[model samples]
Target: MARDYDSQLLESVAVRRRRMRDALLFGAQRARRSTDERLGKVFAGIAIAAVLCAGCVGWSFLQATLAQQKQQQQQQYGTPSAQPSSASSASTSR
Candidate 1:
């Protein structure tokens, strides 16, 4: 009878150990999944920021080019000689 009891006790301990190991493995897998999800979100945010920065740089360059074109146009067509007689006389008075 004592031997049977010892055997039953050993079996129960083994079962408990197996359950503990499974729980530990499941917890580790869950942690890994969570970490992967967070990393994906972080990389996505970084990509968006990079794209926005590029867009802003492009817009600034476009604005500068437009301004330069406007200045060139003014110099070409809107010179002092192109002014009306009244406006030029007013400027000389000033």
Candidate 2:
């Protein structure tokens, strides 16, 4: 009877140890999953920010190019004449 009791106790201890190990492994898996989710969110945010920055840079470049073209046009066209010269009018009247 004593030997049977000892065997039962040993079996119970082994079962408890297995339960503890499995619980620890499950907790570790949960933590790893949470970490991966957080990292995924962070990386997605970074990607979005990078894309926005790139778009802004492209927009700025386009605006600068347009401004440069406008300046060139103004330089090439010269200013418009506001009024006729007096010397030409006097010669035409005579």
Candidate 3:
């Protein structure tokens, strides 16, 4: 009878050990899933911010180029009226 009791006790202990291992594995899997979700969100936010920054830089460059073109056009076309007066004054003086 004593031998039978010892064998039953050993079986119960083995079952308990297996249950504990299963619980630990389940908890570890849940933790890994949560960590992966958090990392994915962080990377997505970084990608969005990078794209916005690039767009802003491109817009700034486009504005600067347009302003330069406008200035060149004004210099070329806006000075013609003044040149005729200057030439007439010089001819009168001569």
Candidate 4:
């Protein structure tokens, strides 16, 4: 009877240790999953910010090009001359 009791006690202790190990493993896995989810959100935010910055840069370049074109057109056409023509000399000589 004592031998049987000793065997039962050993079995119970072994079972308890197994349960503790399983619980610890489950907790570790849960923590890892949570960490991964947080990391994913952080990476996504970074990607969005990068894209927005790129868009702003592109817009600035476009605006600068348009302004340059407008200035070039103005320079090409120029403003009307302010001086009068020199036709009076030819007409008087005729």
Top lDDT prediction, candidate number: 3
How are the candidates ranked when ordered by lDDT, highest leading?
3, 1, 2, 4
Per-residue lDDT for 1-94 in model 4, tens only? 9999999999999999987886776565776766888999999999999999999999999999999999988876664222123455556778
**Lowest summed lDDT window (length 10), candidate 4:** 79-88
Model 2 regions lying over 4 Å from their true place: 1-28, 79-94
Model 1, 4: alpha-carbon shift in Å?
43
* lDDT tens digits, residue span 4-83, model 1: 99999999999999878867766657767668889999999999999999999999999999999999988978675566
TM-score for all predictions? 0.54, 0.52, 0.54, 0.53
**How does model 4 score by TM-score?**
0.53
| Structure candidate 4, residue pairs in collision | none
Compared with the true structure, all predictions reach lDDT values of 0.88, 0.84, 0.91, 0.83
- TM-score-wise, the better of 2 and 4 is 4
Stretches of model 1 off by over 4 angstroms after superposition: 1-28, 79-94
Better of 2 and 3 by lDDT: 3
Writing each residue's lDDT as its tens digit, candidate 2 over 1-94 gives 9999999999999999987876776565776766888999999999999999999999999999999999988876664332245666767999
Instruction: Give the Cα-based TM-score of candidate 3 against the true structure.
Output: 0.54
User: Sorted by TM-score, highest first, which candidate order results?
Assistant: 3, 1, 4, 2
Question: Which model, 1 or 2, shows the larger TM-score?
Answer: 1
RMSD vs true structure, all candidates: 11.2, 11.8, 11.3, 12.4
